[model samples]
Target: MFFTLSYRKTFIGSFDKIGDAIDKLKQHQESYSAISSPRFRKSRSGEIIRIDYGSSDCYYLIEKGERDDRTIN
Candidate 1:
């Protein structure tokens, strides 16, 4: 059986740059493709950016003066 995931958020940046950045990440799925490891839920939600290290994770939070994000229009 094949399970699919729905992406509510859209990746707006350059595909090449995003791929390159994904390569630079240490613990993301892209970096672990070569390793045979159990796949499970990682991120449940993402706003602007997300990062993960060996044992640590981070998510972007909107603080004062910032409105979650900026509008391009």
Candidate 2:
């Protein structure tokens, strides 16, 4: 089996092992957290509507067949 990492529904990269994919996801989360600016949506009244933060929950690990074209090998 091969593991692939996806962020926001976009495939980032394919990995030979699930551990490797997970490590990469952690790296992404750490980097995202380093951003100084906070992400959020504001309302017309100038009130804070939503706040966004870096999280690993958004990253997905998908299992792919070894023969799958997206597999790294």
Candidate 3:
């Protein structure tokens, strides 16, 4: 028999430059998008999780998963 698990992770912190943070993730080829609303919306089955840009240089990142039920969206 085999079993599977859903994985999720979030990164929250402040950065001196947002571009710097973006550049770092880009290097890893991690796909991401900006959160347009206060809440994350669900779309297709394979929706790419989004990140939020807070006041100043603060930000939040949500990792995507194959089938993440942990999030509302």
lDDT of 1: 0.30
* Model 1 per-residue lDDT tens digits across residues 4-71: 11232222222234445444343344443443452332342333343322233322111112222233
Using all chains and alpha carbons, the TM-scores for the candidates as numbered come to 0.24, 0.40, 0.26
Q: After superposition, how far is residue 33 of candidate 1 from its true place, in Å?
A: 19
Write the number of the candidate with greater TM-score, choosing between 1 and 3: 3
What are the runs in model 1 whose C-alpha is more than 4 Å off? Answer: 1-16, 27-46, 57-73
**In TM-score terms, which candidate is top?**
2
Alpha carbon deviation, residue 19, candidate 3 (Å): 0.5
lDDT of 3 by residue, 1-73 (tens): 1111113333332234546644554433333434233332222234233333333322334333333446423
- List model 2 lDDT by residue over 1-73, tens digit each: 3333333344445677756755665566466556444342212223211122334333334444443555332
Off by over 4 Å in 3: 1-7, 10-14, 30-73
**TM-score of candidate 1 to 2 decimals:** 0.24
